[model samples]
Target: MKYLADVTTIEYNADKCTGCGRCIEVCPHGVFDMNGKKAFITDKDLCMECGACANNCEFEAISVDYGVGCAAAVINSMISGGEPACGCSGDDGGSSSGACC
Candidate 1:
């Protein structure tokens, strides 16, 4: 399902973006589009926090807050009685169990 409107944590830096289209090619949800030579965020909410775009972006133009949005993460958090986290587990040691919401 779609997340809350305008709640996207993805940030795109035009200066850092080389218009290489890597983000466009890697994003499964079509969250990005080509605006001439620049990349644009067409549907930020479509992001599932999978980190695919960020991982594929060599320029590091995309930044996200990183939240738990996967079913495995949610189930693991519930079973562990801990805050669900992005697959990365956060830098703070997974103290907060909030979803991508």
Candidate 2:
């Protein structure tokens, strides 16, 4: 499937990573692999575009643009005439008002 560019891709900063393995633990897609002590993006294409790795990273080493990758979610939101929470709006879904639709 061709994913939209709105989905956040994972970017790794080698200098900031501390080999903590937290990102690996939280990722559902096995997008990362441990190289010695630090993490590397071994399978970027297999990524589900989830932000779990970025969220769990304490050192800010990993960055991703996360949002709902589900077509059903987008279609449903549109049908209902409401904005979706797909994270593609450049919002992290961390707001109290939940305005990231």
Candidate 3:
């Protein structure tokens, strides 16, 4: 399912990307694709803001505004004026309790 359609906070800098495909390899949501020798964000809306692509990018080409993926968290973040932190534990976007959902 679409996690946050039209609202992904992930940013990709092609100039910084080494085209090593690490982000593509690490992203669990298929949010990126190859664009010649660099990486392209093919589906930004599908992103869960989990930070997996950002953490895995050695060149620091990827950056994500991490968030706890829910409507309450979004409202809370707005009220608190703080960035949301997706509580994903790893590249697989699993919860801390080891659940995918």
Candidate 4:
């Protein structure tokens, strides 16, 4: 689920984290981890550009611009100047409407 580093906009401020585990709980990709009582990014590459963690963080520890899932195939493809091949066209990653894929 990794995208170009420049295109993904995940910004995490550990100093602002409260270790409430909200990010860890809401992230579809296990992007956050617990270290003592603070939350930290486990792998920035695993992020799908979904804004769940940012939207859920009450402490303002996380912030991100959204995109890069099956949902962004069309947009990302255009940016890369290629045919839509995000591996999302034919399959729904999981939603009944084929939205996840």
Give the best candidate by TM-score: 3
Q: Give Cα distance to truth, residue 30, candidate 1, Å.
A: 0.5
Q: How high is each candidate's TM-score?
A: 0.67, 0.66, 0.68, 0.64
Per-residue accuracy of model 3 over 1-101 as CA lDDT, tens digit each: 88546777788889998899988788888999998999998878888877888888999888987756765445545655655434444565423331333
Clashing pairs in 2: 8-65, 67-86, 68-86
Model 1 weakest 10-residue run by lDDT: 92-101
lDDT of each: 0.79, 0.71, 0.74, 0.75
RMSD to true structure for each model, in Å:
7.7, 7.5, 7.4, 6.7
Which sections of candidate 2 miss by over 4 Å? 1-8, 75-83, 86-101
Backbone clash numbers for all candidates listed:
2, 3, 3, 3
lDDT of 2: 0.71
Clashes in model 1: which pairs? 83-97, 84-97
User: Once superposed on the true structure, which residue ranges of model 1 sit more than 4 Å away at CA?
Assistant: 71-101
Q: Where does candidate 4 stray beyond 4 Å? A: 1-7, 68-101
- Predicted candidate 2 versus true structure: per-residue lDDT over 1-101, tens digit per residue: 43444344778898999999998898876778899988898767767767888888999998877766666556656665554454333454222223444
Per-residue C-alpha lDDT of model 1 across residues 7-61, encoded as one tens digit per residue? 7788889999899999989888899999999999988889877778888899899
Determine the backbone clash count of candidate 1. Answer: 2
- Runs off by more than 4 Å, candidate 3: 71-101
TM-score of 3: 0.68
